[model samples]
Target: MTDTLIQTLDVALGERSYDIVIGPGLLGSLSQHIETVSPTARIAIITDETVYELHGQAIEQALAGRQTHIIIRPAGEAQKSLANLEDILDSLFRAGFDRSDLLIAFGGGVIGDLAGFAASIYKRGMPFIQVPTTLLSQVDSSVGGKTAINNQFGKNLIGAFYQPQKVVTDTDLLKTLPARQLKAGYAEVLKYGLLGDPAFFDALEAGLGQDILDLDEAALTKAIHVSCATKAKIVAQDEREGGVRALLNLGHTFGHALELEAGYDGDLLHGEAVSVGMEMAFRFAVEQGLCPVADADRVSAHLAATDMPRISDMTHLLHDPAALLKHMGQDKKNESGHLTLILPRKIGETFIEKRADREAVLRFLTQLRDEA
Candidate 1:
């Protein structure tokens, strides 16, 4: 691979800033990158069983001479819990890891969240690198420092704003993803365009969607680069999600509620939920007369082409509007006892509405339930 295939985007958070390197076949050079951050730090790789099986040998070969330990967990959203977090911490402690060692998150979003959370609490804080293997993690979760495990209360409720020392996103790894998984991640890529870049969305709708799903090298690299750049800019501006950062959660409020309702099972992937949530946000906006019906229709049409689940697809599993409303209320973005929702007025225009009315929200959700 030529150097041109690898693209690097920087997340500028002053002293906590790091580089997100996007490319295919970049894993072989991972050790060289980590050495730049911590030349002699021992390595603790946190990955799921499936990923480790597929890519563990490559990782082992990459760090041939280094002192490395591998900690594997079962792969699934349900695995992102306090129990798993505690087990990882205990295992790392037993492995003789300390503050100076590094934790390498080498899987999808779930592993990244779990390992990042563990790194944050272990020894009060430890340096870590994000080797995001999944497209979703590469574009969103891996770049940002927001790491957390899910609790009974909500998703990502028990987490911290901890940045990684470096992020290595090898696009080559994405080739192994199942079609469903790739589509789920594509939802996030589509989100970047929907939230802030209409041109990107236009391109996706115009045929870039197929290129991305097909894993065309140039198209895949470009998509991941732009997505990371968007995320990096947002994280730099609002490290703890106090302002414009809320825009990144455009579809999360509604989507997360649905995920919670589905019990985070294989029934609804995070990105799938977000895809449906984005549609719901636009649909709700149109219903309130806050967004033009044309724009909402366009958004739905583009996402529909990607084959992501629509609100109606999961409506059968969700019959109680009040229950979903309760989950939305638990969103970390809520402020002053009011639910803060990210609503889109157009393709590239979105705003945070902090005074979301609970009764009105319930009414809208009831209408959606009726459609089922």
Candidate 2:
């Protein structure tokens, strides 16, 4: 629980494996890690305006003597687009950065995704590091090799599985995060528990949830470590989501649909959408006889207790079940025109239902809309 305590977890991918270093005040030691991974590589730090303003000086001081270029974009989910990716690539080319150079994604999920995608395709390929500042990015996006940019069709429609050279998560940076964003990130933390660890879920329900939301050092660190450890194990087992990795998308199918309906206009944060989506997943499972009503109620109760978003809180965006269904149809998980959903058989137990009945999904949405 001390600020000096650091925990390291590895995503074992044979030749591509890397370590995720988690601790408070990690930025101070970032340069050493970077040097170890890309000692002779020139650096390009890609960050959004907000993050740069908040912690730019610290990062600059950390890598003081290293050759580096800073690229700062406007902060928001909207920035994760093809246009921005092109702009970043252009900047890298203009700066004469090459495959041997290093790129650092120095913000939340958006920056991580955009910069990561750029690194993936820049001159065939380039090594990159993730210095994720936000809680959401630290625990989830930063650990996975899934880098992407959004298109008009849907979220992360264009992307590649490009692993980073390293991930440095400084928990201290989270002190500046808005309460809402922090809560949003906690949704992903809750997710690892809901998806596979019942004991973790129980711990959350028993006050660990509030401890994390309150930013208690020990609690927050434990949550982050456990979430990343769970994800690392899964990614190592299935690097490209070929099989078990799909379980990580437990609430994402429904969540991404809600996000599309919200127009990605910042109205609904990704974690918030996932919060509601997870509840919906549990309820839908009950409807399908895959789970019990009691399990569904527990899921809802936990979200409500923690003040996380639920279906009732997002009624305005849930007005049209048909439209939501349309968005769901576009989910990347679909195969052969059949809906692929990650549904729960119970808390801590989830399975990929690749052949989900489309009409059944529609009816489920309709029922949710009516209730809302």
Candidate 3:
């Protein structure tokens, strides 16, 4: 994982295939990467205020001789809205951007999702690239091409599966990330292990300190590389969450509900909500005798050890069980009006349960509320 030992993982979608470059000092090579896809194209950089402040000059210097238009907006989950998406599209139009121009998403998950969604609809789709600055975006959201914005009803209720031309993940950018943001991002890294690789989970548990929390070069590199590969394989097979892809939502069913309950405010980050929701999923699975109570406890202990939030931490900010259940019903993963959820059978193994009972979920939510 030396600065020079870069890794390139490809998402093989035949005609739409693209490479995800994982390494350090990649922003300087931005123009070189773009030239391969849209040569002679101007760049429209969409970033939040924070990322623009941190990497604006570096990006400018990288695309030094190229024509670039910068659009800086407010940062946070709340910023992912129809209004903001409209603003971004308006900005691109004002710059007279055409089909050949490139849209670069240069922030964390929110900015990436918003900008990519904008790129997807602007003039019937244009090329977009991801320069994910946060650990969460690098390992999960950015790699999957799941662009989205939030609505009054639910999280990601509006979005598109628009792939990016390239994904540049410079792990060095993570060094300046706040400890909470880093820990939040680790939740997604842990998801791969929880969903399909027990050995990977074991490795993470044993090396939680240096490998994960501390962002050790080799460890972090391996985590991002493997996570991207896992996602690429699943997306290649399922593309649009028809079947196997749903397993990736192991914690998201409960997580999205929590996000809606919080009103997409900073009070609960997407990853932290997923961490708590994963804990709830396992605990619920045990309640239904689908998984062992011991297994559920072990998963909770691991997340807790990483300083992640427990279900109780954010439960007080939410409503009653019925209201939360209503939110879960509106998730996009549902089919035929059934409440679908990705539940774990054990560590490194999970399944989709469309038969998940609403009453059962209500009971579980009530139990969690009481404990909280």
Q: Highest lDDT: give the candidate number.
A: 2
Enumerate clash totals for all models, in the order shown: 0, 0, 0
Model 1 earns a TM-score of: 0.98
1 against 3, candidate with superior TM-score: 1
Q: How much does candidate 3 score in TM-score?
A: 0.98
lDDT of each: 0.91, 0.92, 0.88
TM-score of each: 0.98, 0.98, 0.98
* Residue range with the least summed lDDT across 10 consecutive positions in model 3: 207-216
- The candidates, ranked best first by lDDT, are 2, 1, 3
lDDT of predicted model 1: 0.91
Q: Candidate 3: global Cα-lDDT?
A: 0.88
Cα lDDT tens digits, model 3, 1-372, are 355558999999888889999988888888888887788558999998889888889899989999999999988999989998999999999999997789999999999999999999999999999999999999999987788999989999899999999999988889888998998899899999999999888888887533668878778888999899999999999888889989888789888898888888798899998898898899999999999888898898887777787786875755488888999999999988999999999998899998799889999898777776
lDDT of 2 by residue, 1-372 (tens): 354668989989999999999988889989889877997548999999999999999999999898989999999889989888999999999999989999999999989999999999999999999999988998899988999988887999999999999999989999999998998898999999999999999999999999999988878789999999999999999999989999999889999999999988999999999999999899899999999899899999999899999989988987898988888888887889989999999999999999998899899998878887
Looking at model 1, the pairs that clash are: none
Among all windows of ten consecutive residues in candidate 1, which has the lowest summed lDDT? 309-318
Candidate 3 residue pairs in backbone clash? none
